[model samples]
Target: MCILFATRSHPNYELILISNRDEFFERDTHNTCWHTNSSILSPYDMARNQKTSPTNSETFGTWIGINKNGRVANILNLRPADTPPNKSSKGKVSRGMIPFTFLNTDSRKDSFSEWDSFEKFEHQYPCLTTSGDFNFFYGDIKSKSYRIIDTFGQTFKVLDQNDNDSFVLSNNTFNIENTKKWNKTEEGMQKLKELISKTKNESNNNIILMECFKLASICSVPEEIRNKPYHVDPAITYDTIFVPPLGSNDGEDIGLTITKGDFYGTRSQIVILVSKNSKHVTYVEKVLHTSDRDCKTHSAINPKDFHQFEFEIE
Candidate 1:
């Protein structure tokens, strides 16, 4: 998963996300783009080859999706210390699949129903390994809402609607406890807007957004265990920006702008725009120049395998 941009307040703030997954199974594969319908379960199946992992019987490990309902979710591999296995051999279900699956379902109430349901399901079909932790967040676009469910130790918190207008999801380490005080939705949004306006003159709005994500990406972990790969392997090291169309409406540009880089790597920009609202994307524009040396390294996953792809919110 590359980068995710979303907001609960502006339905027009349609999500703009891009992913470049490295797969050892397919050598010549390219980055593939997909459009998920109201239901995310189907897309999750198509995105992952369930047969590859032994835990497929319970859950397929993958960054499932973010829905237009302002619901953004992703599963991350937990650290070993964060999740110690039980001696009982009943097996554990893959917690990473919870966020993707929750957004796929139609449950509307945010009263821990989603988390409870996931827990019940995992009790039946356990996962293969129980070493890592599972982290998930759900946000409602209309209400400026957000909820973080750190299910390893019953850690759950909801962000107040008045404190934030938009929230970014990244593959970084962050302290769940410190974020509890971040329920000031309105203030957070205002600050974000100010930051964006101040940086908009930098020639690229996408770069400005990347800066916000980097700041929000701050994570907390024990210094001794920080070096250890606790969560998802090859954690998302790059950032991408999802720009809503120039105007605020649906069926608009559906164009997505993306930037890939880290604090040290070269950054390259790519723009995917939909010319026609047909079943598939028609126009894809990318910046000719790149600031990075490895900009030409194609992803192992083919971006064309998925079809009827467009980044617009219904």
Candidate 2:
């Protein structure tokens, strides 16, 4: 599970993205790496290659990333009911590949029309028909456009940047007003609104945005509810719990006990800011802890282990 927040209409920035990566701690995962082509910081699953694979594997990490082309993609698993049966199911394609796949290709200016003009998306990407349901938000600076693409290949473009300046995406169903259906949807949006209110015109404020993301990531659920399911609550699902998969048995023990053999909590946090005028991108990654492969004891480390960089889109 993950939570992604983005603001597109700020005075100083074209976009601001805040994300928390939640997953099993026993799996081998790398924090961030600058891709060979450009200054794209892609946090990859160390265990698998970039190809079609089962979603349950360790390679199923990272649902967000930004490229040097000034294109950004954020994906979330759609609720089963929201996704209809695929008419073009070829086979299972890794849902994690969506962001990177978009980044690999340059975006066109016309938005949805150009993409839909193709004879078949399943033909273009054989996995699209068979991949698990996903909600993808993609934007490109060159195209000056942003939109959401669902598993069914439906696209909803953002016509008014000001109206849809800020958006929060969690595991719950997609709703603009953020109704009080799921526990995290209302609480997370409320916290984001409060933070946005505090810094009214302060665009591209990474520090405050990072803090807001941390708040949403760590916010506790109600105590009245017993037997809290992690999927229903972002607090438990995205909690910053890091466990190294090597050396120490502590990580395995914590994973077994805390999540009851399910995936662990938040492993990494990323904050990205893109400037509209200059098209310069600022990316910051906070790796919560070092793996046991590097440190034997699986010791607790500071969240300040940040890897940051800035680059301009050519």
Candidate 2 structure quality by residue, lDDT tens digits, 1-314: 56677776555666667776655544566667776465466776654345434654323334677776677777776542222333221225556666666666554332433443113334555666565566677777666667776665665665246576676676544543433345555556566667666665666456655664455355353434322223333234433222222222222322111222333445567778777674777777776544323233222244636788788876
Model 2, TM vs. native = 0.71
Question: What is the C-alpha lDDT profile of model 1 across 1-314, one tens digit per residue?
Answer: 22333332322222222222211111111222343344442123222323434554533433434454334454433222222233221114434355555565443544333344335435533442341344455544334335554434343344353554345433332353443322222233344455545653453424533544333332332235332222322212221121110111221111111112211111112222111221222212122112222223321121212332344333
lDDT score, candidate 2: 0.55
Question: By summed lDDT, which 10 consecutive residues of candidate 1 come out lowest?
Answer: 251-260
As a whole number from 0 to 100, the lDDT of residue 166 in candidate 1 is 47
Q: Against the unseen true structure, what C-alpha lDDT does each candidate score?
A: 0.33, 0.55
Misplaced by over 4 Å in model 1 are 1-38, 41-61, 68-70, 80-92, 107-131, 156-195, 199-314
* lDDT (Cα, 0-100) at 121 in candidate 1: 33
lDDT (Cα, 0-100) at 282 in candidate 1: 21
